[model samples]
Target chain A: MLIWRKTMEMIPGGTLITATPEEGRQLAMTMARKSIGAIQPEAEVRKALPPKYANSPDSLTAAAQVVALEFATIAAANKYWRKNS
Target chain B: MLIWRKTMEMIPGGTLITATPEEGRQLAMTMARKSIGAIQPEAEVRKALPPKYANSPDSLTAAAQVVALEFATIAAANKYWRKNS
Candidate 1:
């Protein structure tokens, strides 16, 4: 029983293990946001630009794609919803 | 007239000048995508993960925010859609 529990907790190639899907989702967004900041450090510029694309569906879709990409990476790292057990 | 046209083409502090809003939008998306790629180079992983978040609003919103942030930076650099006269 002890070994089984331990095995469940340890994902072979997983880089992270969240307690819930919500946590995992948030983590993925945070990672994505941090990555954007890494390349573009100007907060003021980022703040001023959302309104321009707020009504543009194409731009929003493009942005969604990026977010999805980040989430995918996080999902893989967490072994696709496998909890920390 | 010639000097006026030349002056119009040169934006004082602009880093880029697109021919139209469509072009600017495309450029901004490209920059955002490139930045994401720079931070996360695993093409296979990115390709596999978007479908997971396709139905998640929060994730999509977060992604849009990042794209908007990138668009904002690009807009500032391009002087807010200022065309190359």
Candidate 2:
């Protein structure tokens, strides 16, 4: 059984500081999408695969953790949502 | 302009050790997909958005860097591809 828990460990500190939380959120999503593209370059193939695990709770939780982790990193980088002046 | 750079910093060390590179690769992709799902739960929306940036070199490069960073972490965790006996 391939357990996904051990693959990614959250590292403290983010490299990019953004102007706002919304900017950070959008950037995080974009990075996530881009990462997917890197793994599977073919958009059609990616389109066909989501249904397989769309409703799987474990997968969803794992995915949310991934995004949350990314978002947290962005937030931390921006000093907990401090807007760049 | 939302510059995508500096949001994520590469963290050293992977938590998961796999039996093989192939397993690690699959897990990486799965994680990537799940992250996307977390950001955009609607499968239809995700399906529709790929074409807009599929051919964008910057996005692709960023995506590839994301995957590469992930793979590097996994590889490091597996001790440079050493198989678990």
Candidate 3:
């Protein structure tokens, strides 16, 4: 039995989405579309998506936590020494 | 002078925030608030956020790219293994 959780909330407007892992993923894919470093094309990567899917849910969640921290740290760094850097 | 960029767009609503490095850090900090594995009590960790802040912009940007791809891959995974996992 999968329990859907509220993972991300949109800014500007305070709307939120609560999703099962499967549903959460679909939503993530939609948000990431065509962003910088985005995947080239879904049609091109169609083969890659299937076999490797669902290999490790816990690991992925853990990885997201780490990455989020790292990104936050980096964003924090951009604050200093503007005139010097 | 810092160049601002569009990093994320809120879902369910297409609104976006364009931010310079300093500004972006503030935004990221706000979103990561109270998230699972989120930093607890910004005051307790205020010291941590300040000293380590703005360490590397290029690296952060690169890290975000890799992290984005990794996240998308994980999201893609949830699409599978409903019956098995």
Angstrom error of the Cα, residue A16, model 2: value is 2.5
Worst 10 residues of 1 chain A by lDDT: A1-10
lDDT of 3 by residue, B1-85 (tens): 0011233332112111212333333333333232212212233333444443236565355445444433333222222224434
Give the Å error, residue B11, model 1: 37
> Who wins the TM-score comparison?
2
Candidate with more favorable, higher DockQ: 2 or 3:
2
For model 2, how does the per-residue alpha-carbon lDDT over B50-78 read when each residue is reduced to its tens digit? 47556767655554544554455445545
Q: Rank order by lDDT, top first? A: 2, 1, 3
User: What stretches of model 1 exceed 4 Å from their correct place?
Assistant: A1-15, A83-85, B1-85
Question: Which lDDT value does model 1 have at A12?
Answer: 20
lDDT of 1 at A5: 10
**Arrange candidates by DockQ, highest first: which order?**
2, 3, 1
Better of 1 and 2 by lDDT: 2
RMSD of 1: 21.2
